[model samples]
Target: MKIGDTYFSADVETDGPIPGPYSMLSFALVYAGQYDGQTFEKPSKYDQIFYREIKPISENYEVEALNINQLDRERLQREGASPKDAMNDAWDWVMSLAGETKPVLAAYPVSFDWTWLYWYFIAFSDKGSPFGYSRCFDIKTAVSIKANLPFSSAGRSKLPDWLQPEREHTHFAVDDAIEQAEIFAKIAEWKA
Candidate 1:
C-alpha cells in the first residue's frame, strides 16, 4: 500500500452558512483514495465511510437551509447525537482509518464544507481537529489546475466528462460524499 495523505471526501449539510449560530445537521466522509509521490491508489469503492447527525445548538436557523436537507429539527433535538459526541466519534473514526497515513479532507468546493466541519471539530472536541488546520484539498481547484481553466469556470457543469462522477449530487451528506469521492479519484488518476 502506498503511504501518504489519504483523501477523505467530506460532505456536510448545515442549518445555515456558519456553525455556532446554525448547526451541522449531518455530515459524511468517504475514503476516496491516496497518492504516494509516485502513484495513486483508488479505493475499490467509496463505501468505507462515516456519518453523523448532530443536535442543533441554537433554535436560530434559516428555514430554506433546513428545507434543503430535509432534516427534522425536532427529531434531531430529541434523538440526534450531541455535538461533542458526534465530533469525537468522527475524530476517532478518521484517526482509526489513518493509522499510518494522514487523512486529508477533500471536497468539491472546500470552503463551505471545511468551514463548518473545522468549526464543529474545534468547538466540540477538546482533543482538537483531527485534520488540524489547512490540511484540505479542493476538488474544484484541482479541476481548475488540471484543466488549465480559470477558477471561476471550475463549476460542476464545466467539469470534463472524464472527471465527472456518475452518482447524483443529492443534498444527503453520505450520498454526496460518495459522489464527490468518485470525482476526486478520477482527478487523482488523471493528474498522476
Candidate 2:
C-alpha cells in the first residue's frame, strides 16, 4: 500500500518508439496516490511537470511523428534540463511521497514511457534508479483493448479549432504529462 509516503504516475516523451536510438526527451510524475495492493486514487496531482525538450536521438528515423513536439533545437539547447538533473528530481519527488517500496507508475503508454525513462535516467544520472519497482503498466494499451477506440490519423485537427493556440502547443515534456492527467480524469478507466 504505502511505499514511503505517496503513489506516483509517470508521464514520458520519447524520441520515438523502441529503445537505445530513441532518447527520453523529458518526464514527470504525479504523486496523487500510492499502490495499496492494486488500487489508485486522486490524492493530489500537479497540473504541470515542466521539463526541457531535447533533440531526438534516433538511428532509424521515421518522419511519422518527427515534429510531434515542434520545438526549435536552438531554443531547447539553451533551455534544456540535463537528463541527470531532470530524472533525479522527478524520481526524488516520486519517492519522497512513496514509502521505501516501489509505487505504481501509471502512464498512457506504460511500456514506452517506463522503459525509455528508466533506461535513459539510469544511464544519464549514473546514480541508478532508486524507485525500485518491477512492473510497468500501459494505460494506452490497456485502454485500447478495453475501450475499443478506433485508430485515427487525425490528431489536433480532430480537436476543436478553439482549442488550438496560434503558437505551437507547449511541447515541454511536463506539459504533455499535464494533458494526460486531465484526460485520465475524464476517462477514469483509460481509453486510447
Name the candidate that leads on lDDT.
1
Q: After superposition, how far is residue 9 of candidate 1 from its true place, in Å?
A: 0.5
Among all windows of 10 consecutive residues in model 1, the one with the lowest summed lDDT is 183-192
lDDT (CA) per prediction = 0.89, 0.53
Candidate 1 lDDT, 121-173, residue by residue in tens? 99998677889898999999999888899999999878878877898888999
Tens-digit lDDT track of model 2 for 1-192: 344324345666555676576655556665434444445455454642434455445444445434875544445456767766776676666556554656566666566677876786677655566555455555554444444554342243343343232334365556555554544443443323
Q: Give candidate 2's error at residue 72 in angstroms.
A: 2.1
Give the worst 10-residue stretch by lDDT in candidate 2: 151-160
Per-candidate TM equals: 0.96, 0.64
lDDT for model 2, on a 0 to 1 scale? 0.53
Which portions of model 1 miss their true places by more than 4 Å?
1-3
Sequence-dependent TM-score of model 2: 0.64
